[model samples]
Target: MSELGLPLSEQSLQQAHNGSREEVMRVFDEQHFGRHHAKRSVAQLEEELQKAYKNFILANEYKSSKLCEALYTRCEDKMDQLQVLRLPSMAKFNAGFLLCNRSFEEECVGPSKTIYEQRMKKMLGKSRSLFIKEYNHRLFNWLVAFSLVMVVMGRFVIKFILLEIGAWVLFIFLETYTRMFWSAESLYYNPGWHFIVAIWETLVYSPIIDLDRWAILIGVMLVILVLYWRCYGRRKHGGSWLLPLYRNHEGGSNRWRSD
Candidate 1:
């Protein structure tokens, strides 16, 4: 797509050249739009644009004018004029929010930078963050509604034996996913499932299975092993691959270095 500097087939290129606003909106997701509090940032907007363009191509398995229209429609204003384009969440965040370098309006306009800036200011408020907040708030509310629907459907789907088997598999997956998810941010607030697994192992697989205190000792040893590995890796590797620190200094420092 032109916005994202992606290559398109001849047919796709032709469609983009003549694509309608609605065609573009359907492909736009939350990340394609800026953060709720930071819409004015061009970098965020462009990142979203590039992501939208790629996702659109991928999702449709090719370009269709119809798909493009749907993408455009997502970002269109209440008056039916295209406001800001949307990007899929995957596309949006992968493009990196904080790394965005263009103005919000500039990113939205894409190739037509000057025209979009003039039109955008005329149509929307100037505060990028305010625009982002409102957009994201609306999106968040939509997600909550969608989640409720899925929960209801999930309950229905879990009633049968086949579905129950599927559900059990899903439950296992959810456990693994939840552990990874919660452990990434706040392990304390996370439910004790991981610890429960640890405890279960300690009780079942250790001393009981071995008929000695070795299991208890093994659990303690495993904990120490993990702790040591983490500490050692951080100190020796000088990379944040395993123990990824959400560092404010890294973001700010990178920006400062560029300046």
Candidate 2:
């Protein structure tokens, strides 16, 4: 990682240099050579100054660029490690945000406020767009989740839950018939393998679900879907119920608030 870090550092430094070079040249040409001198005549001298400054930095070998590269590598390592962990995704996201902010400030913001503002604005705009895009994604996810809930309820409970012991006996007879003729697995398949495993692990270690739990699960999901839909609709149109409504202390209604 350290070996790789050096070249990454060099590239970032080069980018930093490139971004500021024209601005630096403009200022140097104006101040050093004065406005009376022709701008085209100073191009060679400007290139010399840029090369000298870069070479001097390399010769002196400052650690800021290297530190930025190390920080980036560490952040990448953390992300890769977190992918294997069961920790909450939000926590991982926050950690990543912190890492970027740290690296950005350390590497780029030290030069000038103008540079910092441009970098920060670009970073923040990208983040805001990403957040909105993810919000839209979660709405679709909620619809899928609700549909899955309905499918599970219809398949397991509505179809099989009311069957009596007589039905079981019939199923056994059919099983015997099928085993003799067809030579295949049982007809009544359990779709919830993970849920069954969870129940078993709970009893041995927490409680398992039986046949009667589907209705209650469906009800809970319905309530969740309603809440999610309400929130999602509000957010899509620039309102949010999750955020508390406070009387504007700034002495204004919606328009004033926007301003």
Number of the top candidate by TM-score?
2
Candidate 1 lDDT at 31 equals 37
How well does model 1 score by local distance difference test?
Answer: 0.41
Off by over 4 Å in 2: 1-62, 69-95, 103-121, 153-259
**Cα lDDT tens digits for candidate 2, 77-118:** 554543432212333344456766666665642223334446
**CA RMSD of each candidate after superposition:** 29.8, 23.3
lDDT of 1 by residue, 5-40 (tens): 333344554477446333544454433654654445
TM-score of each: 0.20, 0.27
- Model 2 clash pairs are 202-206, 203-206
| Per-prediction tally of clashes | 35, 2
Q: Candidate 2, which ten residues in sequence have the lowest lDDT sum? A: 204-213
